[model samples]
Target: MTTPIQIGLLVFPNMTQLDLTGPLQVFAAVPQFVPDPGAEIHLIWKDLTPVSTDAVMVITPTVTFADCPQLDVICIPGGYGTDALIEDQEVLDFVRRQAEGARYVTSVCTGALVLGAAGLLKGYRAATHWTAMDMLGAFGAIPTHERVVVDRNRVTGGGVTAGIDFALTLVGEMFDHPTAESVQLRLEYDPHPPFNAGSPATAPADVLARYEELIAPNKVRRREAVARAATNLAG
Candidate 1:
């Protein structure tokens, strides 16, 4: 019998729910698309407790870091809480250990920052939320502006809703295109955004300026945090 495909998603306080949930929904649907060996997905945190997200939703971790089983894939989702996680030694240690054995080490949005903090993206091309793309260089990563990027075993997705596309890509890699297409059909993954302002290049000049200004303070904090994390990794 084929070993079950084990996937673990890191959960933390103040994470963007969509970052975790979007990819999660696609991975969870794997069994419906392809049977037999199946897939097992788990929410991993410091403890098996409920964690609040950036939005109104709260998620409970299915396993604690200490108790998490060996996983085939480790996915870290991004959010405001990533600032704290970048400097979190315990969390970084857990991620580092898991990535050592996992077939794929992945992230969505700012979650790539967490992977960078753990020193997993060095010399690899990765993707993250547009606002934080340049910051990847601080961790020795080549930042790419794309919806999803795969460099070796490190697969990263761009901001927010890109998680779904990232997960579907992962499914296609693990199974086949037909299987992923079927899952996408099941979820009715169609996009037709009324606005064409998803990125800095596409957004109106005024809108882009406003977003940059709003995130400036957080960006400063992230830079400092990433520098410190890089130091820790080097040490």
Candidate 2:
């Protein structure tokens, strides 16, 4: 029997729930899907220890980085922890290593920052939270303005809530458009932002300005993290 296609998603502390949870829900529903057990996905991490998210969520990883099974696809998701994970020696080391053995590497939101830190985003066109997209250029990525961007094997999603779009796109690539459509139907993935302020272009100038102001502090920290990681690479 052909070994099943396995997906390993590395979850770190404070990972955005929507990042992994969105993909998890989409992929888990695959079996009831289209006779596609080969497309199974698992949550993984550096250690099987408990990983806390934001403030009130936690889950013990199913496998450690060293013990992880071979993966056809691996994803890293963004959250507050992504800022730290991007600089963590152990976590970045794991991402760098696992990416070597997987066919595809993917991320969401600032998770692209982690991929950039891992040196995997070099020469790739990618996207992230609009508020943070410019930093990808700093990390040597071709900045993009789309909700989802894929270059070569590295796929990235924008902001915290784009996971559904990213995962559906991934599922389409892994299976077929029919499969993706089926999943979308089940998810009612049709989006309807109540305020019309989701993206920079759609939102009022004042709202966009407010977003920039709010995220300015995070960018300061993000730049510091990028600098430290890049310096490490250079040295």
Candidate 3:
């Protein structure tokens, strides 16, 4: 019998729902496209309750931290809630324990900050939301400004929607190019953005400035949180 590939996605309050669900849909479809894919995804949290997301969506976790099965892949998705998670020892401990045995440790957007808080990203090249890319340095990670970054067993995606690209990349890594391509075709994963304002370099200067100003307070909070988390990891 083929052993099942266990995958866990950590969910928390105020997370960006797409960050967790986008990759989930891709991974869930693997069994149909690949023979005996054996991929099983579990939504895990500290408790089994419905967690509210940044948007109007809410998700209930399938398992608790203590009862989660040993995983082949562990993924963390980011959102506004990440600021609080950076200082959460329980969540960090859970991530540390799972990462020790998982084949892949991955993150989307600011979720990398949580991984960093868990001491998982030390010396790894990772990616995160563009706004927080520089913050990876506090956790000893070399931050790369790309949609998806792969360094050894650590794979990370930038921003919210990039989780789709990250998931496809993981599929390619776990299976093959053909399998990933097949999944992409099945999902019609094609990009044709009407505007070229995805990145700071491409965005209109005024638009970018407006967003920066809007998020300034959050950034300050995150910086302080990262500092505290880094200090905790150091000791």
- TM-scores for the candidates: 0.98, 0.93, 0.98
What stretches of model 3 exceed 4 Å from their correct place? none
Task: Tell me the lDDT of candidate 1.
Answer: 0.94
TM-score, prediction 3: 0.98
lDDT: worst 10-residue window of model 1:
31-40
- Give the alpha carbon lDDT tens digit for every residue of 1-235 in model 3: 5877898999999999999999998899898876575688899999999999999998999999999999999999999899999999999999999999999999999999999999999999999999999899999999898899999999999999999999999999999988889889988999999999999999999999999999999999889999999999999
Assess candidate 1 and give its TM-score to the true structure.
Answer: 0.98
Q: Rate the local accuracy (lDDT) of all candidates.
A: 0.94, 0.82, 0.94
lDDT of 2 by residue, 9-124 (tens): 88888888888888877887676676635566678987778999875879678888888887888888888788788778888888888899888899888899888888889899
- For residues 1-235, write the lDDT of model 1, one tens digit per residue: 6778999999999999999999999999998877768899999999987999999999999999999999999999999899899999999999999999999999999999999999999999999999889899888899999999999999999999999999999999888999999999999999999999988889999999998999889889888888888888788
Better model by TM-score: candidate 2 vs candidate 3: 3
**Consecutive 10-residue window with the lowest summed lDDT within model 3:** 31-40
Worst 10 residues of 2 by lDDT: 31-40
